[model samples]
Target: MQLVLVRHGKAEDPAARPSDLERELTTTGRSTVKAMAKGLRLCVSGKVAIWTSPLPRARQTADILANAFRVKKIREHDAIAAGDLEVLASDWRDLDPQPKALILVGHQPHLGSWAERLTGAVLPIKTAAALAVDLDEDSALSGMLRWYAHPKVLAGLADR
Candidate 1:
């Protein structure tokens, strides 16, 4: 299975919101989304499916990427959802997709932890950044890391 992990765009400072869940993406965050979308549109040339955190920023970023890809397929996953990392890894480890590719849009700490838990490697999942892993059919949750795309790199695609 091919897994793509996307960290949600930068959001408003949590202190300004009543709850972290309510904090929306910043203007720069939206730009980041655009960049991520632009980047994906260039690389990974294939049909794509999207999964996202319920958070506005993540959902919004998914929206941007979905639009860019002309892909309407989107779902919500608790793995990236403020839940347990080990559990998410176990569940996702068993999916056969309806889309040509899989993209997961979510938040940090959980995203970072799940990535490490699944890949057995520590890599920073920066805001709006995405990492892609290639899993052998028999690969375990802690499979080998393939390659990843940073939002900054994707955003750079716009200028090229």
Candidate 2:
């Protein structure tokens, strides 16, 4: 299966909200994500499932992707917000019909960690950046990085 890891778009200043989970995407962030989603749509094909952190920023990013891909359901899971790869793997194993492609939208550092774990590459996951990995059919944990795109690059691709 293909795994696409995305860092949530730029959000309000951390101090602007009492809870980080409540912080929302800035106007510019939303537009950037929309363009990035267009680029992402160009790269991925087949049925795709989107899972996102419960946090507002991540959820908003997932929403944009859902629209871009015309995906009907977006799963909101704590494992994504908590960045628990173990739980994510267990949940994925439990999927009734695993999708051909999966997109995970979440925060940084954690997303970067996941990329490193899956691809053995030290990736710098900037906000709104995305990395694609092809997971081993035998084990979800094992995969190779297919590509990594910064928000700027993806937005540029959207113009094509």
Candidate 3:
């Protein structure tokens, strides 16, 4: 299985909203995410499934990805927001016919922590960052880090 973990793009200052969940991506954030999406689209092939947290920022990021990939629908999964690594892994494994690639869009520490747990490597995923893990049948935790890309790297790819 291939897992692609993505951190939500830069969002409005938390202080700007009473609730953190209400925070939306800034203009720069959207542009950065669009670049990241373009880069990702080049690498991804076949059927892809996208799951995202319900939070505005994550949903916005997912929307960009979905559009880039031309996906008909984006699935919302609570485990993405809850940041339960085990549950998220289990959910992925449980899919009847697993997708060729799974893209999960969510927040910071959660996404970072999930990547660490999966690959046993401390990967610092910045805003609009993405990490791709290649997992054998054994366990999600045993996956290997295939590639990691941030906005800067993706932006360079987008320019070509």
Candidate 4:
């Protein structure tokens, strides 16, 4: 099985949005997510499962990809961290794994931090970027990073 962790697209600054939960994705963020979503569709084959943080920015990002694939609507998961890696992986392992690809849409530090914890390397996954980790067949719990690409890169790829 594969796990895909995605940081939500860029959002209005904390001060600008009326409420943190109601903040929407910026124009740039929507474009970037569209490109990234296209890249994911080209790269992975299977029914995709998507999860998102409770925050509005994440929900907006998920909306950008709503037409790309059949996926679960955004669900709020507290384990998706703001800066804690432990929470990301801890929540990941604890969650039930289906046979298909699982995508967790969430925030920073937690995304990169969790990748570091799992792969022992700091992967700077940007807004709307995704990282795929390969789980071991023996344990089926832990994993190692296979590859990760940033939203910018995916957008570039989509432009080509």
Candidate 5:
């Protein structure tokens, strides 16, 4: 199974939002995510399952990815929220047949930590960045890092 981890895009300044979960992506964030989405489109084929945190920024990022990937629906899961790695793993296990490719849009530290836990590699994932892992088994810790694309790198690729 192929799993893709994505960090939510740059969000409105914390001071500007009353609640962290209410923060939305900034203008630059949307543009960068669109470019990253373009690059992501080149990486997979067929139906892709998209799971996103209910937070506004994450939901917005998921929307960009869904549109780019032509995904029919995006599932909102509290498990995908920041710092919920264990829940995320459980959610993965609960999927019936499992998707050929799964795109999970969430926040930092957690995304980075999840990537490391899955591939056994410490990957620095920036906002709007994505990491692709190929799992030999359904286990969260049983995967190889196929690729890690920073938002800048993906944006550059989209330009090519």
Candidate 6:
């Protein structure tokens, strides 16, 4: 299965928001994420499933991806926000009808850490960046990093 890890777009600072989970994506965040999502659409094919952190920022990002991918629904998974890599992997393994591609939208360090754990590459998962991993069929915990790019690069790709 192909796994796409997407960091949520730039959001309001924690200090400005009463709750971290409530922090909304800024206007620029929405625009950049839309561009990034369009670029991602060029790289993906077949049935795609979108999973997202429940936090407002992540959910908003996921919504943009859903529109780009033309997927009607987004699945909100707590593990993505909680940074429980094990549970996320297990859940991926247990998907009854696995999608050809799974896109996960979530927050910072966690997304970067998960990418490193899966591909053994310490990637800088910038805001609105995306990393694509080809998961080994036999091992849920391991994968190859097919590609990684920040929003600028991805947005550039959208033109191609």
Compare candidates 2 and 3 on lDDT and give the better one: 2
Cα lDDT tens digits for candidate 3, 13-122: 99999999799999999999999898888777788999999999999999999999999899999888988878888888898799999999998789888777778889
lDDT of 4 by residue, 7-123 (tens): 888888777866776777888888788888887776666867666677788877766665676664655666663555455545555666553676778887777776776667688
* Superior candidate under TM-score, 4 versus 5: 5
Candidate 6 off by > 4 Å: none
Q: For this target, which candidate reaches the highest lDDT against the unseen true structure?
A: 6
Give one digit per residue, the lDDT tens place, for model 2 in 52-119.
Answer: 99999999999999999999999998998887999998788677788888999998778989999998
The TM-score values for the models, in the order shown, are 0.86, 0.97, 0.95, 0.81, 0.93, 0.97
User: Ten-residue segment with the worst summed lDDT in candidate 2?
Assistant: 89-98
Q: Please give the lDDT score for candidate 5.
A: 0.87
Number of clashes found in candidate 1: 0
Per-residue lDDT tens digits for candidate 1, residues 1-160, read 5677888888999998999888888999998788778877776667677888888878888888888888867777766777565555566655664344678888877777767777877898888888877655674465667777788888788779
Clashing pairs in 3: none
Query: Which residue runs does candidate 4 get wrong by more than 4 Å?
Result: 18-22, 81-97, 138-141
Model 6 earns a TM-score of: 0.97
Candidate 6: residue 70 Cα off by (Å): 0.8
Q: Give the TM-score of candidate 1.
A: 0.86
Please report, in order, the local distance difference test score of every candidate based on alpha carbons: 0.77, 0.91, 0.89, 0.72, 0.87, 0.92
Error of 2 at 40 (Å): 0.4
Pairing residues by index, what is the TM-score of model 5?
0.93
Clashing pairs in 2: none
lDDT of 1: 0.77
What is the overall TM-score of model 4 with all chains considered together? 0.81
Candidate number with the higher lDDT (2 or 6): 6
